[model samples]
Target: MGTADTFIKNRLDERKASGIYRMLKPENSLVDFCSNDYLGFARSAMLKNNIVAEMAHYPDSLNGSTGSRLLSGNLKYAEELEQQIAIFHEAEAGLLFNSGYDANVGLFSSLPQKGHAIICDELIHASIIDGARLSHANRYTFRHNDLESLEGKLKQAKGNCYVVIESVYSMDGDTPPILGILQLTERYNANLIVDEAHAVGLYPAGLISELGLQNRIFARIVTFGKALGCHGAVVLGSNLLREYLINFARSFVYTTAASFHQLASVKMAYELLKEVDDEANVLRNYIFLFKQKLNNNSQYKLLPSDSAIQCIVVNSNGNAKHVSGQLQAAGLDVRAILSPTVATGTERIRICMHSFNTLEQVKLLTSTLNTITHAQ
Candidate 1:
């Protein structure tokens, strides 16, 4: 057999030995407590119509971008979308990437230099970790959301320091102290990069803007796939940073540009998010109620979070997977986040909430979970 086949077989054997082999399943329409479409914009008819309407004004808005963006794929629509995103997020400029993963890799690998140090949270997204690994910078991981620990690491940094974190952590669904992080960044004369993938479109107005920390950070990565109900992500930063990424970020420079349809859809999604105040309010209420219900139930251990994502620690990967499977068999869509994905002893079931999920579904899912766990 070929080298590629042997490599795949070896990897599969390793995973099987570790009891961590994973396989994909067909999409199911069970009550969603797992999708990232927080605002229900993925299925929004109005948003779809708006994209179609925009595309009708330009017939070339379909199909793949012909070549890499550095080549023939550059288009007027991309620039327009980036401008809209930058304005909306209150950044000096925004550069779009194919996905959040691309944005992370592009930013992390390209921003820090050989003499710089990258201090990241131990629990940051895998993409960020991978990017940091690819970077030439010296890297260290502080305790998750522990500013003091990060500060200690900062003191030991040898050169230019970059502090990286997510606004809302994907697995844990908790937020770090933004003001404190910014303070540390300034104190150490370091650059701060925030990945707002889970917070954008769900946070009030502009998340970074709402905190009034727009001008203080080096970059903010806002993703459209999660709460925005679209594909792609944007790295928001200074005009200089945008230009730098255009030239040096391999992920952005080498990949084909996003299609015109995707750009139009992202623009439409942002517009809808801006106008749909009532829907946003409803989502906020649902989140509050969900948290209240989880808190009131003393039987299960819910991670501390105020966002749409929540986790229940089950400790063992096998147990967590079994619990998740039980919930799925009962027609709910909760997912088990296994070890290796998380720390071995910290594996849990991750539940993602959506604005469109009804109160009845939330109540039923909670009750079922309570019963399953024998929670009082």
Candidate 2:
């Protein structure tokens, strides 16, 4: 084989040696504590029916968009979905992207010019980091969620500056101090971008809307895959920004638009978010009880979070993987967040709470976890 292939295989071997090799498992019928389908809309019959009905209206809506959006893939439903998202999020406009990763890479790689700078949180998502790496701007990382470090970096920026962060950290299950970060962004006259992938459907509203910071941020990226229980993502911004991305964002321009069925499901998920109070409340209560149980256990420590994600820090990757495997054997479906995915010293087992998960299931899994750790 090629030398490049050999180099990649050697790297894989090194990862295996460090106990951080990764693999995907087939879907199991076990109780789920690992999926991002927080609202359980992914499997909803009502959503399925809505998508079917919408597709019937456009008989040609099927399999794929023929080509890139700039060519033939731009469908009427794509524009309709963008309008719905902008109205729901109270933004001037919204632009649809195939996924959150595409949206981040396109925005970060294209927006900031050569002399400008990007100051981002160290713990931001990998897609954001990859986008920044491809950018022409000089990039620097501030301490995770530390506004003081961000401000220090802001003072050193030579040109137009952008401060990037996430509303909720994926690995740590914690939120940043947004108000303080906004204050610094304003003081330094820098644009602010918040990736709300994990917070979109779970929060009372989105972080920007709930905190009344929508006007302050230059852009916000929201995904449908998490709480919305669908595919695709949108970038909410001013009309001028929307126009800019339409012309300049390569990811949006080159990719075929999402199909009509996907757009219809996204719309239905938002409708459910407004109407389904009981289901949402049940999930919230389970989260509260789960946290209380973890607090009572001396061996396990839960991170500080009011969102749907929770993490139990198990410092070693091998140990975290071992605990997760035991939980799976006992019929729970929790996932281990391995090193390299998370920082080496902070490897964890990520438990995603869902609206469909029962109280007994939560208690059983946590108790099983307690038993496993205490046994060691």
Specify the highest-lDDT model's number: 1
Query: Which segments of candidate 1 are over 4 A away from where they belong?
Result: 1-7, 204-206, 295-299, 374-376
How many Å off is the CA of 187 in candidate 2? 0.9
lDDT by residue for model 1 over 115-192, one digit each (tens)? 899999998999999898899999999999998999999999978898999889999999999899889889889899
Per residue, candidate 2 scores C-alpha lDDT tens digits across 113-142 of 899999999999998998888889999899
- TM-score for each model: 0.95, 0.96
Model 1 scores worst on lDDT over the 10 consecutive residues at 367-376
Clashing pairs in 2: none
Query: How many angstroms is residue 355 displaced in model 1 relative to the true structure, after the best TM-score fit?
Result: 1.0
